[model samples]
Target: MTATIIHLATPEDTVRLGQDLGLALRKGDLVLLSGDLGAGKSTLARGLIRTIADDRDYEVPSPTFTIVQSYPDLRLPISHVDLYRLSSADEVDELGLDEALMEGAVVVEWPERAEGALARPSLSVALVSDGEGRKALIDGETAALARLQRSLAIREFLAASGLAQAERRYLLGDASARGYETVAAGTEQPLILMNSPFNPGGPVLRDGKTYMQIAHLSQSVSAFVALDRLLSSRNYTVPKIHAGDLENGFLLLEHLGGDGVLDADGAPIIERYEETIRLLANIHQQAWPHEAEVGDGTMHHIHEFDRDAMMIEVELLSDWYVRRISGIELDGVQKAAYVAAWDAVINQLNGCETSLLLRDVHSPNILWRRNEVGIRRVGLIDFQDAMIGPSAYDVASLIFDARVTISPYLQDHLLGVYIHERNSAGSDFDEPDFRKALAIMAAQRNAKILGIFIRLDERDGKSYYLKHLPRIQTYFDRVVRHPALAPVREWCEKAGIFSPES
Candidate 1:
């Protein structure tokens, strides 16, 4: 029963409203647009499709005659259907919208012609003439309504930041609810609108704290702003925050080019990888403050990636992966043994050198600016979950990236590059200790990733991550063989954690 009324002062406002709602659209969603002739229904639909297509000037000819027009190549393939000519609700089935929805979402104009045959829509927009403009009465399911409200909030935030006229296009979204959009204003190069909402923490599960709290995940966008400013101060290549709404969790950030460490073929670029390692070495070599004052006059405190956090993440392997993947539930005795094994491994990190770790320095978070010289070519991002942890964690994360199938030769080369850079900088780079830390961190990360990928598939219905499980498993199997993780390897083997049957 969630509903909202939006006042559109102009045709542009109507289009913008559509764009706002488009941000929330997903596959299998039904967006019903009802209105009289010349009520801007088609115009609004055009804006929505264009936004989803990430092309502002995309041509969206009216589907009035065609009955249906499908955009199959877009990120979210959608079909625009016009039911104005339907004689009865029974005719609705002839349009094949139900079949279209199986591929993606559908936007139906003149849905009133369908009577009650259409399925319950995720969103319904009723447009009415208001003076020279229009008024839209919107209502939808709770999740859809919340997403629409958040999208409108982003619009308001952009307006307050003097980017009301900017063209916003869906860039990308992560496994988390956070999303990113590319905003273009005039000719001033594209900027990133970080659409991160305050996490508010999830349900409390342990020690009267939520999983996010135990994991030390960033609950506020201010962490990103603070870290960005901190790194920028140190001459590291991070997005520059032009404006931010700390409370509302919106940030207008610099777009640090589109190139990443991966090439067009999605293979790791060797030269870029070497430069990234150099950048990481420089960052690890520096001393960082535990707290920093951001532009908003609020102090952002960086948390330590303690043993508790690492242990909780490793437990994911048992909690989700073991049950779902291995089809076996761990008894109390087995669970405790598994925990004890991880405890011993995490304890090994006690005396290891600690530094600010970005947690995920994988290919996706890295951007390459080939035009920029030296380390400046490497742009760092997605570090909101940054923590003070073993510097080797970030190195391990990159070398054993969960997203890509890194060859063993490439892996060894990258490790060699990191170690050489650390040594070349005259940092007391304990080769043996660093190698051990890297192995332990690699195993821990891969275990957590396996659990997360399974959880994402079972809980979130995001099956895309399941493809990465094999790569991560291979990586984990290799790293757990290290002597530093002997106890963990033994426990996993005894528990049939990675049996051939699994």
Candidate 2:
């Protein structure tokens, strides 16, 4: 545990730092507050609670008397605990403070009273009173340390980039190892702080490399910075990189509002989805280079969606999903056939010229700007995983989204619109070949999602992904209906993996 000593010059400094930490806190996290009776432990906890509540003036009364207060009304549930009044360790146990970690993040005052009764917290902040101020000592484990380090660097970056006093607020994050926050400095427009540090994958699983390496997933934020510059220059709706630390993976990007193509019921809106595909066609019309400029005299090379990568991705269906759902394991021959089918399709796509494939082109990554005109109205995010691959791969990603259910009728219509847009641009876009590529990619993508969604549910303790299993099956069925995917269809049918009707 490394100790970080921060000198809080004033009460304002203490609250400001607390707000920054508050944005980083999430469920299954803990923060231990230790201090003397009047060393501002309650003050710091109050700052966190108020910030999360989005009510600066809300009275966060200390839980010294009640021992705990639950703010279930807030967007993120919070449980505030006070160990100051607990005379015995058994009393702390009776309060069941550990349960708070599972439900939401907990902030405890005078946690030393419990001694070894609870698990180690994500952060332990110790306050010591100075003459007129205080000094805070922070300590945590690797994950927590990484977050703290990033927050410290962000504070420094904002200072250097002239957004020093920006009010940092928590924004939504996804299953990926990435985090985002909104920073509003003065009355100026808000900026997004993308915290996507390089997280090295575990042991070498494939060809002396990790899964991330095999998948060509971005390890750092430089790919994003480079792709952002390239797409923005092409008149696309990519966020502008205002300030950044590429090596350390901290970026200050323009905030694209979160108005995605999905409606309130989480279904695809017709006009927005059509516009999104048109934007994709417009992007595919251009000739993009394999190498792109990142910063001063530095260039980044985009990876290709080669046959090996394609096979490895589809293998996820066996590695994670089938293994978990049905306990169905693949033998050597079964695995080989799966690889061969994917290899045939990926090789077929490589025959023609390729375009930059932003691997993630689903609704979650798309933003709809009503005020903007033409293709510029569609804002794209999550391009760090982009590669030079078949343009049809992105088309499949859009129409066969995992989160939003794309019916066969709607999918066909969207596909037709995409083709029309390409033909309107006066390109020799072959419809039949594109359909075959789209079919292959749909199968490839659906296989990945089937495994990925199950992995998230079974291994990661996120059960909500199980709700989309049937939807993924339906899309997977649509994939194999094409003649090019007959082998994969036969394998899946004999395996009896998907649902009957699906």
Winning candidate number (lDDT): 1
- Candidate 1 off by > 4 Å: 1-3, 499-502
What ranges in model 2 sit over 4 Å off?
Answer: 26-28, 54-59, 72-76, 115-122, 140-143, 499-502
- lDDT scores of the candidates, listed in order: 0.88, 0.83
Per-candidate RMSD, Å: 2.0, 2.3
lDDT by residue for model 1 (1-502), tens: 7469888888899888878878888888999999999898998999999999888789999888888999999989989999887678898888888888888999999998888899999899999988767899999888878888889888899899888867788998888868999888665679999988899787998899888899999998988988888888999889988888888889998898888888788889999988988888888998988886677778888999988789889988999999986687899999999999999888888789889999999999999987789999999989888899999999989989888878989989988888888888886879898889999999999999988888898989889899888889999989998998998888878777654224
Leading candidate by TM-score:
1
- Which pairs of residues collide in candidate 1? none
Tell me how far the alpha carbon of residue 475 in candidate 2 is from the true structure, in angstroms, after superposition.
Answer: 0.6
In candidate 2, which residue pairs get closer than 3 Å at backbone N, Cα or C atoms, i.e. clash? Answer: none
